[model samples]
Target: MSTIYKSEAGASEIQRRYREALRAWPVPAEHIHVPTRQGETFVIASGPEQAPPVLLLHGSGANATMWRNDVTTWSRHFRVYAVDLIGEPGLSAPSRPPLDSDAYALWLDDVLEALAITSAPIVGISLGGWMALDYATRRPDRVTRLALMCPGGVGRTKSAWLFKAVLLRLFGRRGIRRSARSVAGLEKLQDQSVLDDLVLTFTQFKPRPAQLPRFSGDALRRLTLPMQVTVGDRDALFDSADTAQRIRQCVPHATVRLLPGVGHSIFDQTDSILAFLRA
Candidate 1:
């Protein structure tokens, strides 16, 4: 499979840091590899074997370890599977599937099948949220509940801002840090190690140069599963108001929350998210 890193050395360094982060995960977990039509999928499984299943998906430029803060609590009540999305900076295969195709849904199906999970609740962040939404639209039967945090695809992305951010990144570390803050609307990152890893990935890794495909109103309407959506009012990518408005308009039964003063990162709302999952 094709790799996403710019060089073999860069890929190795990022993998090393990722492994270090995984070692610090609060809960005991098992790493598993499942073969899929697209590629090999990596997953971090935790919690009791008999507990109800909950699938967790991380955002772009991230891996399963992004759930470190939430996993400890979440694993207590449910069997948690944090999946490393294919083609990203994770242990998963480096196969970049077409965003406009059903490849992601199919890959997810393979993951569930390998784990022997018929149906379960799914929680996703940013691009991962978009992936979960895409899968739910294609196979609603496999998703019992869906929760999205600052998900893409619900509203149009601001291409001009993204372009500016990319240009800023080319200047150097300061420029990259500025771009990161602009995209996330955060003055300071909660975790320094996560920020360091993200910086390395952005500077050294070769990311897929593709934007998320917007979901049509008809597609959103077909998502009948119980759903909860949350976005930051200050999100720099998509218009938060438009995102919530679209979900409310298309999915009438869906619940939406707009966090004030928040940005792209939604890790702080773990308590409420856990409550939603339990409910």
Candidate 2:
């Protein structure tokens, strides 16, 4: 849990690179401040506005920057809109306590309604996947298809990384460093390029940490589309085999696969995801 300051060379570099990356991305990205009952969410839209829109969601402690690399791939076939979950640590506003599934769903629906995007594929990573499924189930008419990357709330307690990150946020500034490398799930994010993406997520949204209620499975029986579920073979929080089995029980034809040695960052599998979306 190393604390990084603005005076730190690496921290400053991450900030410079983030601004440059946003400026030089392949497609046009406009930030949307969509308001909801609780607060407003910052969503980034890439590709053509008229193209079929696809929503991308990031995991906890991360932001829309998680899907930066993938936006280039998804833009060719569909308009890509990646969101910083309202209460996430990215560019979105924070919510007070009393977080709930219905609140999450309502906030998400508000974003879509404001954007006038009624139906399109939703690609969610970790918590994003959890929200996608919850939104689809609650208002089935809004989501066209569900493509979850090792979705959350599948009855896994370890799905949350906040427990381990607490010490970092509290003592990171004093050089109480943990192997930032072994922050648990992210693999090789210390590399320069990967580090840039992670840094953007960290700086863009300074999350106000709060406990998320354990995700419920009330929508399991409500799935109604060509669902695709993929997880990493070594995912610490996601049980790939069990997750696939559960998804199968709901949508029999749901295609599921395990990416070996990749852990829970399934959205990092750009080629695999692009192919899945194209199919």
Candidate 3:
């Protein structure tokens, strides 16, 4: 919808490019659309049908393609379902229900029921991490394990980067690229294609302005399942230190990794996440 994109043309272009990316999915995958109260939700299902299921939830403004680098390795051992979160720049509907409501958890319930999955491990990043926490805490009996990368809700969201991003946008495309790289912590990354994709995405995508609701200590203490959190020390979006501290204080049993020089968009975490999922 226009609410999610700058214009109709941008929406069409984003979807067209998304379809192009899906065609070149690293591993063999089946494109699926599950019906939910919100609308049709898109998912990329991979790995053997008999393998244990592992759900993957990417951050805001990203689709299942965010998992392209890791899916090949992860799918080797588990049935991977990379879901396109609603209201994001994915093939899913642009329906954004209130974050304070039960809409997301219910939508996930529909997805799980449709997939015939009783319980499964979940891997989430940034915004997806918040949603994963929301669902797991509400439906604890349904989640086997949790792996979060720079997840929101547990951390204090920052506003400094946003102000800088806004200023950088005034300088044109070059400035926008700088803002994207800095925000994503991709400054040292050698992957030009990844940066290119990031630039293209932000140029047309209208990111959700609402900040994720921080999880209360009471809500976090309810998670007793196997949990692992990895965040970068240099993250500009969320307070990585606060996230680490809360998880430690609330869920002592959870494994926490605070990377020295990571940002909001963490990459090359395939093996670490796979180990957590398989553990």
Candidate 4:
């Protein structure tokens, strides 16, 4: 059942109906106030508790709902936990002690610990992916398997668009709605409604993490855990093959896949993600 007991859709809407919208949705979620330091709350949603645990993290400027379209399908086989990154929009709170990239990784680790997710499969996309890799490098024992989708921090990313976001955020949160509209209406974004819904709910974003630092390439090599990496062929970030190679050099045992015509957003490559995780 969704922690969100009430909905604008209708209070009388059967639990199943809301679940239908939220259950197999692109951005299906509810408002949960999970406790953190200083009585703060963090919002998160998931597929089911009975399945194998898989925590889903979104990229910067995105939220857990980005996985809504993919979660139900993936959750059928693995328990999927989509988190509203604390210090971000959605139901999370106490967006304080502003951080850098490594700090972001520690914050994630702290959230999982608070959630009691001691050890589990973690799949991160973009910044989330970078966090996952950084976490694994820092404490490989805590993660069983790792999956990174067009993760950031591999090298200089070609995100001239992100600069627009920086400028708009400085202007104020109101600009985000317009930004969200622009993001949702893009031709590549087929599920405009899902992205639209996500953009509408981005109440706050964590203060920016610091510029990319030289992360622990040596630490990443020592982990023997299975790894899978993917990026879109047309991704604006890194060119496909080089994207995989750079990550592969960090962990030679990793398997890398490229999606033709796909971009940086792994949520866009829903089917392939489900297939790889299920395998």
- lDDT tens digits, residue span 118-220, model 1: 9999999999999999999999999999989999999768666678788997888989877776776655667666677777877777766898999999999
Off by over 4 Å in 1: none
- Candidate 1 collision pairs: none
- Top of the candidates by TM-score: 3
Candidate 2 segments exceeding 4 Å error: 1-21, 96-99, 159-179, 188-190, 196-218
Question: Compared to the true structure, candidate 3 yields what TM-score?
Answer: 0.98
* TM-scores for all predictions: 0.96, 0.78, 0.98, 0.71
Q: How close is each model in CA RMSD to the real structure?
A: 1.4, 4.8, 0.9, 7.0
Clashing pairs in 3: none
- Could you give candidate 3's per-residue lDDT for residues 1-279 as a string of tens digits? 468888788889888888898999999999889999989999999999999999999998899899998999998999999999999989998999999889999999999998999999999999999999999999999999999999999989999999999899999999989999999988998888778778877888888878899999999999999999999999999999999999999999999999997888788899998888877
Off by over 4 Å in 3: none
Q: Which candidate has the highest lDDT of all?
A: 3
Error of 3 at 141 (Å): 0.5
* Candidate 4 C-alpha lDDT tens digits along 216-245: 567656768888888777665455676676
lDDT of 2 by residue, 82-160 (tens): 8877655555665643456477777877888888998777888777887887777778888877788878766354534
lDDT of 3: 0.92
Candidate 4 lands at a TM-score of: 0.71
RMSD of 3: 0.9
lDDT of each: 0.89, 0.68, 0.92, 0.61
**Which stretch of 10 consecutive residues in model 1 shows the poorest summed lDDT?**
185-194
Ranking by lDDT: 3, 1, 2, 4
